[model samples]
Target: MPVDIPGPASSVSVQHEPFDVGAEIAAIAAGRPAIGAVASFVGLVRELPGCPGGLSAMTLEHYPGMTDKALEDIVGQARGRWQLQDVRVIHRVGRLAPGDAIVLVVVAAAHRGEAFAACEFIMDYLKTRAPFWKKEETRDGGHWVDARDADDAAAARWDV
Candidate 1:
């Protein structure tokens, strides 16, 4: 019951296996010549900011139905606000080490403004609205990560 939505304009997937970012980007506008801009963002697991000796690894968990619905809602909102021609979202789960890819957002539009804004808007909402939980493995042991105020601020700026 993983969150994988297949559609002509929008695609979303939550998978444990790695994905090819390049191929994903290319597929968004494989045959469509109308797309003028393709904006994308890739999030990665990095060393925990406050960890003493740095993070060893991080694990992500999510409820299948809830996570998918939240992501779809975010994308739906973006589509309404912007003139996005295509959108793609991919999130990874389970054990992930620092430097590993965590999420990918791609948006295609007739102009750079719409594509860029839509990409960021979707990611911002996904950060705040998505049900994914994170746990970090540090020298002290595993600890459930807390929501960051910055993430809230990022999502809040959109005013969506």
Candidate 2:
């Protein structure tokens, strides 16, 4: 799918490489002179307490066509709501160890506020709407992560 923003130089990659915050920000801002500020967010796997089994790794699965469409829609919304120069989202799937990066979001805007807000909005929506399923691998076995009601509520806030 094509990126909605004009200044992004048309780059989007989804892979299992260890995510680097600095590299992602640089790629999103590359050759975009109008971008005065860039905002980025990275999500990582976390261990929870009181679980029956000890967490070891996480594996993510996503619907290809739907995932791409949802990301494109989120980016479009951010562009419409803010004067953003560019936006990019990269989400990794498959087995990931602890401290591994699961997702990265980057937003470029003329000002910091717009960039920050757009980045946040994309994350919020991704947490809820994106058709990505996660499997938590523990010492005992592996299980799919259930959808959280809290995530739904968070996305609902932007429904207007």
Candidate 3:
């Protein structure tokens, strides 16, 4: 689900292809001299601990329009709470193998605190609030993933 958010220093999208982290970061900083700090987080697919064998891959799916909307809402919430100068979120969908990049979050602000907090906030909220679904593939078999309780707890800290 490709997202279209206009007139703000933010861009969010869900795609079926890999992203270039360096390029994305450069894009965020281009023409934005106000940004004094930048923070980034990249999520990768890997075998869950205790699994019989390593995870071969993961298949991610999302409801097109809704997925983009939900991400936009999250970015909006982060912007409202922080002094952010720019933000970019890119999440990949479709089939992906272990070691593949799954998500990228880049945030820029006037200070490190704002950049770090907003980046963490967006990733935490995205884990719980976003509409994407994931299924894991292993040598043994494959199964749809269940939400983690820890993710919920992570998001809860920002309730205030």
Number of the top candidate by lDDT? 3
The alpha-carbon lDDT assigned to residue 26 of candidate 1 equals: 91
Residue pairs with clashing backbones, model 3:
none
lDDT of each: 0.88, 0.79, 0.89
Tens-place lDDT digits, model 3, residues 1-160: 3444433544887887789999988988889889899999999998678897878889998878888788889999999999998889889899999899999999999899999999999999999988989999888898999999999999999993
State the lDDT of candidate 1 residue by residue for 66-159, as single tens digits. Answer: 7777887889999999998888889999999999999999999999999999998998899899999999999888989889999999999987
Better of 1 and 2 by TM-score: 1
- Residue 36 miss distance in model 1 (angstroms): 0.6
What are the candidates' C-alpha RMSDs?
Answer: 1.8, 3.7, 2.2
User: Where does model 1 exceed 4 Å of error?
Assistant: 1-10
On TM-score, who's better, 2 or 3? Answer: 3
> Residue pairs in steric clash, candidate 1?
none
Clashes of each: 0, 0, 0
Decoy 3 TM-score against native:
0.92
Cα-based TM-score, every candidate: 0.92, 0.87, 0.92
Between prediction 2 and prediction 3, the one with superior lDDT is 3
lDDT, candidate 2, 2-76, per-residue tens: 222333444344556666789778876888799899998889888857676778999888776677678777788
Rank order (by lDDT, best first): 3, 1, 2
